[model samples]
Target: MDTGVAIFPTHDAIAPADVARLAEQRGHESLFFPEHTHIPASRATPWPGGRPLPRRYAHTFDLFVAVTAAVTATTRLRVGSGVCLVIQRDPIITAKEVASVDVLSGGRFEFGVGAGWNREEMANHGTDPRVRMAIMRERVEAMKAIWTSEEASYAGSHVSFDRIWSWPKPAQRPHPPVLVGGDGPGVLDRVLAFGDAWIPNHAPAGILERAKELRARADRAVGLIVMGVPADPRVLEAYAAAGFARAVHWLPSAQRGPVERAFDAFEAAVAEFTGE
Candidate 1:
């Protein structure tokens, strides 16, 4: 399996250009940055990690801007939204951003998208949390239409646009690979419906089973990339054995020294696992 790294893009974290150069120089396949528009001070939605929400969640750089920085700093390394909250963005503007990045990056971009988990945050964007999944799916579909059609248009409950002209279509023929993020009960349905791949933040064993199940349900082989992975040879071995395509190690959002130290460890672990 190929190895990649993900980080929270925060104001005080290591600059994204540096992160991209580090990944490219180290021979990592990709770098991903997660997004959060804003974290409501008060909330009813509990963090999935079960601890107090991390400081990085409340202080993130704009997702596309960070991604653009990373991609521009390196020619070989692919950059992505660890999970761009589709439920919170306008499809038209987002489509333009995606296409612009892909065109400028020579197609070195992966579009990893999710509906997101923060209730108050989504609400702040005028998204109803309950129906956010449908909104996300429609937004993705709308973006795809924008990318692939000459006169793009979409009609859906959440997003609708009549034939409009958009320019600088993605460098990638059909656009960047849309990797669906999240592993909820109906996640596979969404993946088959609109995504090019699946990125699940799960343990290796759980991922193996889910990958098998997803492939069994689909007509063609479904791609799998496990995210939020630890720096461990054993975990990577499990993923590789299961024929998963990639393993993304999570790096804490921090200054250059500390974050690069963590990257060294993850790089070592991947080398060890692959016997390279």
Candidate 2:
């Protein structure tokens, strides 16, 4: 499996530009940044990673800005949002951002998207957590329209526009690949609906079985990218055997020394898988 890294790019972390340079220098295929406009202090929605939410979640730099910095700092390394919260963002603005980055980076952009888990955080953006899935679908559909059409238009329950002209159409024809991110019961349905690939967090059991099932269900070849995967050759070999395209290892939000140390360990894990 191709290897990549994802990080929560906070103020205290290694700069995204440096991270990108290092990742590219180390011959990693991609780098991704997670997003959260601002974490609500309400503490209403439990963090998916469980309690004592990491400070990085709240301190992360703007996803697009971090993405842009990373892309600008590397020529071959693909960079993307680990998963942008489409439910909390404006589709038109997001489409423009996506296209601009893809254009500027010579099409080395992966668009990973999802409906996030923080209820209070979503609500802060005027999103109802209950209907976020529907909202995410419509926004993604709208973005796709903007990227592909001369005069784009979309009419949906959550996103609507008419004959809007958008420029600098992405370098990648038909737009950048959308990697759908989630592991809910309905995630595969979402992937089939609008995504070119599926990105599920690494889970110990039944994931390869699920990947096989997803392949069986797809009429087209659908990519599988496992996120938050550990630095384990056995697990990565299993993923490769199951036809997963990539495995993304996470880096802690920290300064250069800690970040590079963690990254080197991940690289070693990947080297074993690649037999390099």
Q: Model 1 — TM-score against the truth?
A: 0.97
> lDDT by residue for model 1 over 181-225, one digit each (tens)?
998889999999888899989654556787888888888666888
Worst 10 residues of 2 by lDDT: 42-51
Q: What lDDT tens digits, residue by residue, belong to model 2 across residues 139-195? A: 999999999999999999888889999988999989999999988899889999999
TM-score of each: 0.97, 0.98
Instruction: Write down the RMSD of all candidates, one decimal each.
Output: 1.1, 0.9
Best by TM-score: 2
| C-alpha lDDT of residue 21 in model 2 | 97
When summed lDDT is taken over every stretch of 10 residues in candidate 1, the lowest stretch is 202-211
